[model samples]
Target chain A: MKTTIHLKLYAGLQKYASASDDNHPIETGDSVREVLNRLGVPPDKPLLVFINGNRSKATSLLQGEELVKVFPPMRGG
Target chain B: MNSFIGKMLNVDLTSGKIETVSIPTEWAEKYTGQKGLGTRILMEDLDPKTDPLSPQNKIVMTSSIMAGTIVSCSAKLAIATKSPQTGTITDGSIGGHAGAELKYAGYDAICISGKAEELSYLYLDPDKAEIRSAAELKGVGTFETEIRIKEMAGDPQVKVLANGPAGENQVLFSCISTERYRQLGRGGIGAVMGSKNLKAVAIRGWLDVHVPDMKECLKVAKELHAADKIDDAEYEIYTDGTPILVDFSQESGLLPTDNFQEGTFEGFEKINSASMKEVRAAKKACFSCAIACGNYLKGSKSDVEGPEYETIALCGSSIRNDSRDRIIEINSICDDVGLDTISAGAVIAYMMEMTEKGLHDFGIRFGETEKAVEMVRKIAFKEGVGAEGAMGTKKLADKYGGAEFAMHVKGMEIPGYDPRGSWAMGLAYVSAPRGGCHMSAYPIEAEAWGDLDPYTYEGKADLVVGLQNSQFAKFSMGVCDFWPVASDNLAKLYSVTYGGKWTAEEVDIIGERIFNLQRIFNIMAGFDGGDDKLPGRFHQENLKSGPPKDISMPEEAFMKSMQEYYRLRGWDDKGKPTLEKLKALGVEDRFVQQYETYLATS
Candidate 1:
């Protein structure tokens, strides 16, 4: 059976995301890094990943988190 | 064969002496232009011990080498002066047509000295410059000052930089307004203009700015535009402007809420990008800019060019006020009155906390929108409670007794980011040459919004130093901060316009040299490692909610990181750059000797 987790992509990563990008289906043991690769983001791109509003590593395994946010490098005030 | 324009203007307001001076060939190559060039000139013009608001103080304004070229985002100017607020060597970069106009008017920079005998404005054109009486423009807001100066010039296209009632009153954080919407908006540079009895600068120029080759310049500019479009895919500034930071700051627990007593705001959703989009009236850009990051919003009560992230965070969550309309109204008032929103919002928030804690009665509670709006005008006009508020946080804290939670580094109030969540940002704030300026070295891009660990002290020293050096170099080029142009592209840009082969490493070294120059100036002005510090709040207080909850930057770890930062910059334990390091960086022998003398005597 597949588990679902909420996903939000920001900045230029929005181009890779669709409206259905939210509530994405994933395998129970999938890593955050793996999910991003599936979504077509460049493998080497640095990202800020947060799971349930807490800073999470890209290699952290997912367990049907309530929400996840991913963003490319951005700088401004 | 370069974009130097070959000359600068020296205006002595007291004696009414307007002289055209040739730019030195050696200084041009050594310092480049803009912030770097301006600092080099400023170092030689006035003494470090000169009173910031006295007639002895001097103001240096520089046009970037890229200004008036086909370079994108090149409409930036640098203003350097000793800050009346912080008593540090402060420089601010402003975006507008004025810098480009300076280039077209056949000048690379302007050095204004001495006080005007009466209230006056400087009018400049290709032929001549005159100091004209501005007694009729007295007590006017910045918005009207710009319009009236243009009308007086009989040229609607005349670029103007004007100060308002706040500047005339010499409010410590008053800003100089340009293009009606943009400002050189930190460290009380406007107060310096006010102290000189200078009201505005009205400039009109039609002379052609030179380049090595016009055809190659255009071709290179086209390529750069294309590259910016492709490389800046992650920059949502054009669409969402700075309001995009509202959501990111909220999620990362970096937003300054309730005078930084907390990191999260319950009403944050009300002022984020999505909400801003609902009222977005128009988008604007600086001269020669393609990205056009300026967003104009129209709310029911007011319309303004911005309440950008800093304004929204500092005026919105920092004050515990969530009304977008109210924020817009406050932003409009501050812009017109020529007050810096960052300092104004931070001061108001400080007073609110003081009031809530029963230390003082400022008559405004947290989240009082109407009272905050009233205070903007009061601070500008210096009325009632505005008198003390206009003096800024450090002075108020000194008088009213709440230094621990004053929320400033040096005397300048901290901008939006709460450093507790992003640990390197704490270092950035404490170590910034200009005091509490996020633009000096923004670590938030790496820590809060990128891949770096936000809660650790490790590796922060290197990150902050690198960012500061790069930022100083970029500002020297007069490029907008929004464009994430690589060092390779910067080298390409220099080669195209100036007919010189520039390596990426050379550009990097220029950045390091400029940073060290400013540090030398600050040290000469009597700042030491002891002056580089965060307020007591960051070390002692913890946020009550969100990801950064119960987290305060550990004082010992932070001090260690700061020392490491100094070491990385080749400064001594007291944060003074050694003479050997200066000689290695090719800093002038005069500055090194001046610094040496200052160290021994002080």
Candidate 2:
């Protein structure tokens, strides 16, 4: 069974991958961390990854068809 | 004198008399001037039961020993009094030229008490102090009043701290605006100022804030200036301003939306930092600060200094209004009307939710925000529903019946953080002396995204307690909250500016002592461990949308952490400072004996 997840990079993280290149798709058995690693986001930069509107992690396993979003950390106010 | 003016003015508005008094050296050494010393004065002089809006309530304005010095982020003025909203020891921090100017004018602090017979303003020059008739300035907006007073004083550099129309009407959330942008923006200090019938305090100075070692002070300052630029990569507060947090918090599930019913707003993209970056016309900073995280925006609504992260959360996302331009305009209006944007937004959102729940409507809907802008003026003037809403969230909830989800702690509205998303902030909010404030201890950097896990209570108690102590100590020195300065750095700066080897450990102890002192003040004023809890909505209900869906604070974990935090503070399980704890913190038993007495009675 072939299944895939769509990845959208936002804000400062867009420097890695943006809509100009369009979102890349990852299949089942691939985790969010795998996608971030491919995009060159450092593990220590406090980046937040959300899978289909839920707080996910770099190590979170994708369940295919999930919309994975990534961005820099939030602070203040 | 090494930055110690050692003098304060006591103005009794009712008698129209002003007296200058010497600030004892021992008191200055123990409390470090600004927030710490101001709290000590309030604890000693004020009756805990005094009505915050009454003549008995006193407003003490002081600067830290660092003010007017070359130290980075050193110019801040601390305003302390019983909050009309929280009924607790509230200290509002104002950043701008005013704090340093007040110091340069040869006074370390100004204590204003009693209600005046008529409207007036305090005029302070380097050599003279007078209470002048401000008949023409009555009921004017803060911006115009500051400008008028500056022109009247004939000094373009005169620093004017003025209350706006909202303060005149005594709005519980009224703020004191300074330099047209910086504000003592929380805990209703302006209402206390207005109640005294004092319109503004304009200061001009011709002296310098002498430091013990100017060479070493400038050297440390240069290092801080260089270090602040390093934070630009992770926080980027300088480049994009605060709106940058919008998208990140939304995705991370911390952004409060629709009166905190949800953790994310779908309308986020339209009003996030990218939009603020596009509209930011200029960058601004307060006093001699280097981080420079401030911005002035020219959006479709108006040209103003930011709808910061909090305003963006409350006005932009909380009510489902995603128009960045409108939010910017609303921020400007809020400034002019003297309303703290956090409370203003929260109260309006409460009314909007009330309308949703079949309560009385002021024609407010989830996504409709234009009406609230009009109500901003009405709130200042005390007109229409603004009369009820200006009373703030707790009062509005009392009138309308939403006690469970009023979203306030001790009458102050909660800021942008949805505690469900950043669990440590829940503890911070509960433990804060001035009710629901995020500035007290922002633990999200560590607990939410840094080393510690955000889900469990494992290290959160230690994290929050430590942050609170450090922050309290930092603010005691009138250090601006925007920059990141380690405790060691603070101690070195203290030693260089003041005299002596003020160790980092001593600074920590001073912070802890100040925290306990404020707690003792609250204890006498009737706060207990019982007050250290969040709104029922946060504990019982769950966030309905986004990454933090249906997640609520775990009861047992929260309780465990709270208890541990108590132990760290040397407090009992009920959050009262034990007599032994007071002794260890160097708080004289006589100072806290009243609180101990209050505990015995209850």
Question: What's the CA error at residue B454 for candidate 1, in Å?
Answer: 2.0
Tens-place lDDT digits, model 2, residues B1-602 = 45888999999998988999988877677789789989987876798878999999999989889988878778889889999888899997887788888888998899989988888889997789989888798889999999998888888889999999899889999998898877775878888888889889999888877887788878977776676542454455655667778876787678888889888888888888777778778888888876567888897758888778999999878888888878887888888878999999888888888888887676687888788787777787889888888899898878878877788998999999898978899999999999999978999887555556666777788888889889989999888776767688788888877778888888988888999899888888888888888888877888877556778998777888899999988899989889988888888667867776777786
- Model 2 lDDT tens row, A1-77: 35666777655566677622333666677877776777787756666667777666777887677887776654465
- Give me candidate 1's TM-score against the actual structure: 0.95
Interface RMSD of each: 2.0, 2.8
Candidate 2 stretches greater than 4 Å from native: A1-74, B227-235
Candidate 1's C-alpha runs over 4 A off are A2-4, A11-47, A57-65, B228-234
DockQ of each: 0.53, 0.36
Q: Which residue pairs collide in model 1, if any?
A: none
lDDT of each: 0.87, 0.82
**Which residue window of length 10 is worst by lDDT in model 1 chain B?**
B227-236
**Model number with the top DockQ:** 1
DockQ of 2: 0.36
